[model samples]
Target chain A: MTAVQWILENLPQILELTVDHLLLTVPAVLAAFLLALPLGRLAVRLPRLREPLVGGIGLLYAIPSLPLFIVLPLILGTSIREPLNAVAALTLFGLALMVRSAADAFGSVEEDVRLAAVAVGHSAAGRFLTVELPLAGPALLAGLRVVSVSTISLVSVSAVLGITSLGSLFTDGFERGIVASIVAGIVMTAVLALVLDLLLVALGRVLMPWRRPAPRRAGSREPAQVGERGAA
Target chain B: MTSLLEALDWVLTADSWTGPGGLGVRAGEHLLYSLLAVGLSALVALPAGLFIGHTGRGRGIAVVSTGVTRALPTLGVITLVALAAGIGLTAPMVAFIVLAVPSILAGAYSGVEAVDPQIVDAARAQGMSPRQVLLGVEVPLGLRLILGGVRLATLQVVATATLAAYVGAGGLGRPLFLGLRNHDYAMMLGASIVVILLAVVLDALFALGQRLLARRPGTA
Candidate 1:
């Protein structure tokens, strides 16, 4: 059968699997955002704490996901093993990106804006909420956009643990010699990634409407500059 | 020397390296796969990134590619690719390439963009063609940033390549994955140590490269 025919044949299974993949990815991102935002704020306030926290997160990020999945079963006693492990592993990696971005967004708030807030007799909390956060909104949203997209892509690996998702379709498709399943999975994944990215860009625009559109042809130098500052 | 030799001996011993089904591959296979992933990633990401950076017309393409590529976890991408292509080294290698491309592209594009506009104007005024301006002016200036991205990509690829062991693609992760499966802490620790060592060494090399690149005249 043609690829199109195969897709049509297994559309329900493909959609179900795609939804399962989103379930795995979406929650991990939300959990990460919840954890990261506060931690990022804390990191900014106590600059000294930033290094150890970021370093720890970086170390966690470096751990191979497959190994982490394998290790999780041992620690968690294999009850709800696969999904739990996937969540935990993805959470750990997501933390690194989320925390980094949160800190960066907060840091990117202009000093002059903060000074202006202070001049108006704004308390520290007031300044952060009104001045810093407003300015940093665009950058933070950009970071979130990045994190969300990344989470979607990484969710496929959860399939290794028998957690059904688009990845499972891909694995099952290839393994079972079901050409339709494979095509369905790849198409579904690519579509999911594209759709999610557009959503993120839209979210960024909504959250930071005051920010100008990103320079169309700006080089990658800004991230490096940000990295240097963050590392320092 | 004795202690180091003993550690080396421990790593090379049959039990430490053997697979469950007696189909265990050599450490060299692991190294080969890692190298292949890194090499392919560099080859694809660097040029594409440079082209995107220079062209300045494909912002949407660049952004979307980086976003999608970065989002997909190394293991997930590899697993999916493996499923489509069949499990083995090739799938993981392709995934690693996909994984590595975004950072490199982002870096290259940014590096080129970061170049002072005046330099380009001067080069143009001096009768340099667009090719000459790119090759002679922009690329040299952007080299450090591009290198920085490559460094980051290399580190990421090496660390993530450990996942390849899951599909029977050999690497240092084999023992770690197997140890996790069998509850073998000694094996896990040994494998983890090797992976950590690889990361540290690669990181150091990149750091050195960054320093050298920074020191080049006119780069700053």
Candidate 2:
């Protein structure tokens, strides 16, 4: 049968696979974001710990996913299911990216701004919440966007461990000689990535309303050049 | 020897070619696949990226295309291609090429765009044709950024080429994947070490090359 005919026949299964794919990515990102923020804050305050923590995270990121998955079962016990293992593996990877960005975002908050908050008799906690986080909001959001999309992609690797996600479509399709399954998986992955990226861009705009939206272009146009200068 | 010890002996044996382990054959195949994929992708992406980047009309499309390509999971792309093309080194090669292109293109396009407009105008005023100005001034000036992209693409491809073993395209990943299949912890660890070492070594080499190229007279 033609590719179109095949897609038409398996529309329901394809949709289900797409949903499975989303499930694999979304949860891991949420988990990573929760863990990374505080860890990032701790790393910044300690300063000396930052190097070791960043280095350790980078080392973990360098490790291949497949072997990591194989090894995890030994440490965590064999009873751990595929989805949890996949989530754990992706969480480690995503944390590496998120932690550094989070730290950098927080670090970039102007000292003068923090001093101003302190002059107003704000407590330490109050200053962080009102001054630092607000100023660092855009960068932290950018980092989250990157982490979200990266998590979506990494989840596809989880399929190798027999986790049922959209990646399974590729595995099943390849084994069964079903062309539609492969196409369906690709189209779904691409669409999901696009939608998530747009959502992140919109979120950036909403949170940083004072800052104008830069032209969505291929090369990095400096924020200053895009006429959004000094807003940060 | 115990089964575990025997596997260790096989991996550590210096002469992997005639030894029970498939290490030499796997490493050779892995390198070949990586080089071919990166080379082909660079060839395709450099020109295409330059065109799209220079045209200035399709910046949105170009940006989105690169982001989507980079964001797609490497394993998913490989599995999908392998499904359509059938399994082998070719499948992974095709996948890496797709993966490599967007980064290279982004690099090239951005490098070209980053070239100072004043330089291009100066060249044009000196009676240089548009093509001549692009070839003579823009490309040379943009070399560093374009090369930066190539370095990143090469590193990504080399690291990811380890996945080729999933489809029976032997590489260091062969032991890694097979060890997972058979629950052979030693083999997996051995393979993992080799893969990580190779990635780091290759990354260092590319970084060194970038430094040398950037420092070369008339290039910086």
Candidate 3:
């Protein structure tokens, strides 16, 4: 059969795999952000804790995903067949990456701003909610968007671990020597990544309404430009 | 804890140290793939990044490509390339090179840009050529970020190269995947420790290298 015919016939399977991809990614990214925020705050509040805490997270991020996926089942005492292996490993990675970003996000809040909020009789929690969170919005959202893209692509990787996310198409095509399937998997993955990226950008715009084009000034200062977040 | 002990014991075994699939050979393969990818990527990306940083053009390409590259799944790239290219190192090479390129590109360009413009002006005022300004003024100061890119790319490739086992490139991933297949938790954990150890060691070495770079420019 021709490539188009094969893809046409397998449309349902591809769509199902896309859903699996989404399922694996969404929770992992959400869990990552939730976990990373506290760790980031802890690192920042206690300056001495910053290096080891952030470094530990970066070290975790450095572990190979395949090995982590294989070993997590054992670590969690679950069967290799469980989807939790993929989710847990991915979540750990997502957290590892996002921690530094989150810390930097909180650090982006100026000390004067904090003092100004205090002058208005705002409680600490109230200041964090009303003042810091909004100012930190761009970095936090940008960090999430980067991690979300990373997670989406990684979810397909779980296919080799026998989870059959969008990545299954690659394996299926390779095993059968069907070029269309592999090509379809690549195209679909790209499409998924692009779509998800757009959604995240839109979400960021809605949440952070003040991020409009600004005039570039001389020596325009920017806080540390984290890796993979140049756009933000 | 018992499983962890068993894994530690497994790594100490003499049998595990020698054979076609021994940790030594696998580590070598992992190193080779990571080095090949990072080295090739740096070669192309550094010069291009420097040019872009120096001329202040093509920044958008670097930024956009980095995003797109980050979003493209590494596993899919490996599998697709492996299938089409028919196994061996070709698959992993393509994947790792693609994965590593964006990082080195971004790091070098941004690093150069981060250099103090005043310093470049000083170099020029001292009758230095543009090339001299780049090499003498920009590169040394921006070395940190340029090296940061390499460090990040190396770590990424080291981690990702484990997929070599899946695509027939033969790295440390063998033990982990085979262990999974045979339900040998000890072997899986042992192999993972090896991969993790490699990552930690490499990261430390890079950090040390960065420190050395910092020292050199200051002393000079």
Query: What's the true lDDT of residue B81 in model 1?
Result: 71
DockQ-sorted candidate list, best first: 3, 2, 1
**lDDT at residue A215 of model 1 (Cα atoms):** 77
Runs of candidate 1 exceeding 4 Å displacement: A1-12, A48-56, A71-82, A118-123, A194-232, B1-27, B44-48, B51-88, B123-136, B166-168, B176-193
| lDDT: worst 10-residue window of model 3 chain B | B211-220
Candidate 3 lDDT tens digits, B15-94: 89788889888989889889989999999999999888877778888898887888777877888788779888998899
Q: Pick by lDDT: which candidate is best?
A: 3
- After TM-score superposition, the amount by which residue A180's alpha carbon in candidate 3 deviates from its true location, in angstroms, is 1.9
Cα lDDT of model 3 by residue, A1-232, tens digit: 9999999999999999888888888889999999998888788789899989888887887777776786676668876567877889899999988999999998888989889999999998898888988998889888988788788888877777689788899878877888888888888888987888799889888888899769898667654432312221
As a whole number from 0 to 100, the lDDT of residue B78 in candidate 3 is: 85
How far in Å is the alpha carbon of A190 misplaced in model 2?
Answer: 3.0
Candidate 2, residues B123-175, lDDT tens digits: the string is 77799876676677778788888887887777678778878988768778887
| lDDT of candidates 1 onward, in order | 0.71, 0.75, 0.84
How does model 1 score on DockQ? 0.19
Of candidates 3 and 1, the better by TM-score: 3
- Every model's DockQ: 0.19, 0.31, 0.46
- Give the candidate number with the greatest DockQ: 3
Q: Taking the tens digit of each residue's C-alpha lDDT, what string does model 1 give over B1-220?
A: 3333443566667775566422146345655666676677778777777766666757688887786566554654565577667777877788777877788889988887788766776787899877787788878899888887887777777777677777668777676667667765556555655676667677777778788877989675
